[model samples]
Target: MLNKDTLLRIGCFLREQTGKVAVYGLKLNAQAVYWHFPKSIACFLDRDINSGFFCGLPIRRIEDLPRNNIHAIVIAASLSAESHIYARICDFCDSHGIVIYSLYSGKLKAECLGKAFPAEENQESELRKAIASHDIVSFDIFDTLLMRKVLFPTDVFDIVEKRLREHGIDIPGFKNYRIQAERGDKRHKGLAGIYLTLAEMLGWTDSQAALVMREELAAERQVLVPRPGMGEILSYAHDIGKYVLLVSDMYLQPEFLQEVLAENQLTAYDELYVSDDRGTGKGEQLFELVRKEHPAETYLHIGDNAIMDGWSARVHGFDSWLVPSALQILKTTEAANILSFAENFNDRLLIGLFANRTFGNPFAVREKLVSVKSLPQFASFFLAPLAAQYVLWLLQRAKIHHFEGVLFAARDGWLFNRLYQAAAEIMKLPNVPPGMYFYGSRKLCISAALQEEKALEWLKGHLVGQTHHFLRECFGFLPGDGHIPPAWGEDTDLIWNEVVDKKESIFARSAVIKDGYERYVARLGLKREGRYAFADLCSQGTTQCALTHSVLPNLYGLFFARYMSGSSVTMGRVETFLPQADWHMLANNALEFIFSSPEPSAASVDENGNIIFEEEDRSDKELKLLDEAQEAIEKFCHEFFSLCESDGFISPAIGHFLLSMYQQPIFAGAGKVFDGMDINDNLMGVRVDCLLTNEK
Candidate 1:
């Protein structure tokens, strides 16, 4: 809220007070004044002004302020607004030859600030001098200079047990003690106590037990790996002229600790403290030793165990830090107490860093890494897809083959035969050709041959006695004479030339046939395919016999075509006519004959000439006739418009047809017309059109 003028005035005032000054806006009022100051005035602003009120100065209004030679306006706003106000003040003071002093809590002392201070150059020089000074600083090794519990208890116990057994020191109860020791249960007693207990149980002499214990202890100690970054911190401290020391309540000898540190590439400390060497646990005595060793320098000790290291340091008047393992620290009930203690005690700070078993260092779990907790989370992860691709590549490298295909029934009975017959008819259709057809149940019969005849024969044999005999039998018609239309004779060879063989290309061909059929039906302007080549095309195999009967007139053309071809496609021979033969009788008789029915007229024909009263009337006669005609019209228009829309296929006559079809409610009215026709015909034209045009 501070304006440019107000900030400039505040900066000028600060410059008068101190040759080089920094202004801090502690609240909203302070920020308002700080922003209007000149660039020469360094202004620091608090982020959250509403939380509290400002009581420092009365430089609120920018207009009434005088422009003086103020050097800085340190906007000491609340922590929240510090960055924002600092940026604004710095930018406003940029061109005025002003140096803005931005106070950062992360780097600056929270409790100390003064108007007159050493120059920036002097501060930098002092910092360098501090770094160059050599001083011995003692640090507790466990949970301080080194990590705690590097190896699992089981791992350490295993090594100890193996060594003890090799030394011929056997005891039945040793295993239980090892288990308890590995778990770090102080209540279970220390390893030294366990070795004595085992020696007593095994009736061994003190000298023999001690000898075996030493060997097992050596083996166990070898497994205690140091924490990551501990050595680095120690080395860094040592490089800065700080003498390093390890103080722990460990039972290992000083020599062993030194060897371990040297192996881990750590600098040798000035002194080392182990319970065995110190003759006591960590306490005031340890601090007394450090004080005696380094009398002239300030010393700080850091460790994980609060009672042993922290309390001792406090009692001895030494600066201390508590750095605990992430897991153990989380489990501790005294975390709040430790944090409160750190807050109240200026010299101590409790630092928490995460460490896992495999990765010993405290590395941040990035937001991106943490996000991969669920399947969808993994899927959306930026690198997950790439990882999956890599895995797939690996699988390929391993030469892992897999099966990919569709499953279908392959029975050679009624339904199977019908399926085959349908497939065969589809293949036999002009411009239709054979391609891959899969058939089987859970246990499938696979064939990759291109010969339609061979495929059909294989299907028939494989499905003949199968549970899905009916389905297999139906599919069997794909290869044989039964599948072929009557127009194509048994001896007539399949013409495989010039037909596009790709499955997709074949499907496209079917779409073209379907389009042509629909357009031809539409041109006739009939509500149904009552009398067109389309109806016949719709009624080919036995599966479509009932369908053909529904659209009687359309099937007439197909029937005629088949009959004329003399291809021996079977239909019931109808030699006898009814006593009273008429248009209705002839139609009913033809349907009955085709279906192999003992009697026609099992259902009645309605006034609209539709067979509307029989459950057995699956034939789409009326609906097919009407819908086919409507669809044909729709196709003609769609094609005509498409052609017109294209660059070279424009025809006014076609356009007129398209316009006429578009205007006439053929699509909307077709539904009504279909409802009036037979149930079989209800969707025949639309379905056929969809099939032909590949609309579906």
Candidate 2:
């Protein structure tokens, strides 16, 4: 909405002006008359009797108007009737001794009148002001602003004749082809069409003719230059706070044109409007941009072609000045007429032209801040961190260690229990203590016996047994599975026989194991006498419980891994998932590290009070170890980051990894004892390993 001050200024100008003004015919023309004139001095006159609704003022016959006291009359007709009314008014004014003044005349007394009319209003007053204010005004770059120059207009005819003479076809009226080609070339529609006509005249094939035309046109385009005064005009526009807008019909690359503009030093336009970059023709796009960026300012559009720029402006409601070269005036008159006609017509013509045209909606203007609708629509950015935190909370409540949903596991207890028992027996040997054993289960513990020198040998033996058990129970295989029988041989069968069948002797030998087994069975409510009791307890406690717990620890591990990954993916996700938490942690950690350091000595201070900080140096050994540890941490973190970045089974993978990290024997050594440890000795090996491996 325009301010009342603008309206009042416009109204004052209308009251003060005394002239026969020719207003292009339009719906708003009559209203503009009211905007410009006092009610007492204004009169509405039109030849069409039915225009009363639009005129607002009472219709008066033009012929019946008294000649006295009417020194000047403004032609407030529709654009379609502008020329017709202008001619009529000019003749009438000349005969009646009245002076005829164009609406665009600079002699108009009111400078503030132009200020009142907004450029976006697309009124004649605004166009005049823009033209008067700016020295250079640019139009469409392609057809309107430039044309292909012909090297030899008459040569087109000569070539056709030469080709015909070679063919020896002395057909009557053969010279007519040359005449037509020359005429077409003069219009500068490009030589391709003319060449096609020449091909027809010479009776050549389409391909042969097209090849010749393409070659010629390509050569011609290399020497292309700006139209006369175009560069100077652009500089002038920039000097006077105007701009050179290259609103083209064809899609032109911005980079190429930008280079051109830069080379010419004509890039200082307050703004540039390019159709290819901005999306479409200058009609609605120009008006929409003007409304957003240059509201209330004046603008002038100068162009050679009329259809692309001239009519586009008139129909779409932007003020346009058509400056067709003197030679092009006859060809552009029809376009000028169309523009004039569109001013009086309703929005129907504009709508029809824009229909099926792929362009951004003119009404969808850019706003400074988010809209109320967007506040809810884009709430995901704000709520994602909260959602992740809630997920973490749920995971903690569940007390789940690992989640292995993506990997396949047998549902039966008997099969899984056999596997667990086999792994446990292998781990319980002299060298492989219960603490050293690690199976893919929570409750079962494996051990082995070997000298310190045979640690690797003992590990190989344990791996063989574990692999055999996995094949038989988890995969439901028999002894003939090649690697299984050979690796297990007789030792595994003997251990299985003694441990599983002779349970009483086994329990007497290891009371801790017996107690753990009993407690596990009790927890699962398995009947002691039943054959399936042990299997049920093992499957329920190790497989089911371990699988459930996998979720929590795995998720935690993934979070930590991503934090250490150093990849942008983790950082980005963390930004979304825990924006405030991440920022707070980073800020706090950096502050603590910075402030905790010793302050620089006074001797190191510069005259400006700036501290000349000394760089901390580290030994090669320390640096090497730090680099290695950082690399390992980075690698470990990358795996988690990769999982989070993917959409496939991400939650399950994260849960499992976290669970494994927390529950693994490697971490257990740090005094963070978990469930299922019977005595303090069970944790000795883990603690020793952590102490040896600790880098800090």
Candidate 3:
């Protein structure tokens, strides 16, 4: 294990050397060093090398390879075997005049490189300069001006395949077959020609082939989004009175491409040149067509392909600006390490969605390696998937159980209810139980349940360490009310005898609270005898117990997680979607706060059926941030539900792993999302300030 200082010194030394450098080991330590200095390090050398590669670098044997122009060899080994590895490599280093450094040593032979994943060059300014100098500005459509929400263009086939199977068209190996269909005799075939090949392979009629082609196009419409700031670049070219042309080596027709452009508000181009319309592509002929039709004093072409857009365009007498694609930029950063864990189809889909959003802005690397611009982007990347998974589980569970309706508990349930309704509609699933936001909280529900025998026990456990204001809030009393003595306002243990004395008074006040809630529940219009279920965050079934015992009997509870210590009467009616082991490992406060509503917690209800909310402790900026985050989560859920089928659902393990990455300090700028945020629990008299600040 190399310490940070040691790694820093070694990286600086390796980067400063002009000649080639090689690591001695071929394991994780070597991979880590390669990531830190990918361009600086040449290759890896080992005694047992068999012509393998690590991190795209070739592996070589020291005895078989020539040592000309070799600079240094760093022993990327554990501390226990560092001395032995150093001794084995020192003789070769001395003969070759190569300096050998230990992974554990703090001193090294050279200077430090500044950032982990620095930009290869300043290209954005150069691109703007080229656009300004040229009369005609040409752009590549795919991965340049426009980007797909998925990682690869062909991932669209996976989505189409999932949709096909959902509609009872389960063809095995459909995605691979679709890929091969396009890769047939001609490489630049149009949509119709590719589907004709698919029809021949699958023994389908022309109509069936056309249906499948339309499915692919629909999938494209769902997954396509504008690359961040590229639209502005195109508009800038147009504003300067330059003729802008969009070119792409794609099978989609020019008309459909225009519609896609218009849909994303990218309508500043003079013309679109598609490969399918001309049977030629940007490799050679598309640029020739672009030049022949639209002559200009000086032409500039901007694209992502190095060979097709740069060299090929230069051959056609046009200057080119080659920008890196989203995938190209993401592969250089720690995102590669994060994405290595994606082993399944669903996992890759999620990674693709995240890649589309996080890397869409090409200049994100200028500020930080992995840039989360705001709280909303943080929510979309880390929080939305977990929230969607919970909703997906609920959708399946509702169908299996045949529940009459779902009652989402207030505050936390506000987001869940909206997500549930949206997902249900998008999936087009039949017989889905109606989900509604139920305005009830622990404070309000526990007040209604004080008459029950176990309510006293619950109160003792939750309110013992709380202040008197919290006690009043729990029992439906307002601050500054003359209901209790002033000395009781301090942080004091709840004396059972003293509570007994106030029991009559508390019950008398709580009666109006119970009546107000009863009227509110009646207004929901759900049948009293229906098999209704309650949806909530982490709980021990207190809300469920109160609702079932007081207002609505025979109510079932569906929780993200449950943490009861002993057996209870509501055990059979309750089911925890998240397992205990997974629940404790997560930051439950963050989850609750991220998915929570901006509205204050429900404190109590008056006799006239008006709900009294807790004092709003959150600042207006905090409220605005929550609203933005909720919108981002909703957008992600909408996209996920629209594209992904219920089959091969996102696993809980993957969801947990993505969330842990956000909560940890692995990504730069993640802590900025929660920098000054606080979570207040008025009923418990607890406030978590600057939560999840990445203090380690």
> Each model's TM-score?
0.31, 0.22, 0.73
Q: What's the residue-level lDDT of 62 in candidate 1?
A: 21
The candidate scoring highest on TM-score is 3
lDDT of each: 0.35, 0.33, 0.73
User: How many clashing residue pairs appear in each of the predictions shown?
Assistant: 86, 37, 0
The 10 consecutive residues of candidate 1 with the worst lDDT sum are: 344-353
Estimate the Cα RMSD of every predicted model relative to the unseen true structure: 30.6, 30.8, 12.8
The best-first sequence of candidates by TM-score reads: 3, 1, 2
For model 2, residues 1-696, the per-residue Cα lDDT tens digits are 223443454455455555433222334655665565535343555555624533455454444344434454554443345435545555555555543332222111212211222324433343445656743344555423343222222322333333334347453454466466645442233344566567766786888666555443333243233444444555556666654455554333465555555654446455556654565445334535544555544445566445445544433334466544322431222222222222211111121111101011111111211121221111111111122222232222222332221111221122222222333243231221111111222212221111122322322343444433432432233443344343333345533432233334323332333344344434444333321111111111223222222221221111211122222332111211222222222222211111111221111222232323333333344334333433332332222221121111223222222222222232233222211211111111111111112211
Tens-digit lDDT string for candidate 3 (503-564): 67677666667888887877788666778888988776777877776678878788887776
Worst 10 residues of 2 by lDDT: 356-365
Model 3 TM-score on a 0 to 1 scale = 0.73
Better of 2 and 3 by lDDT: 3
Show model 2 residue runs off by greater than 4 Å: 1-138, 143-145, 151-223, 251-285, 306-322, 329-696
Of models 2 and 3, which has the larger TM-score?
3
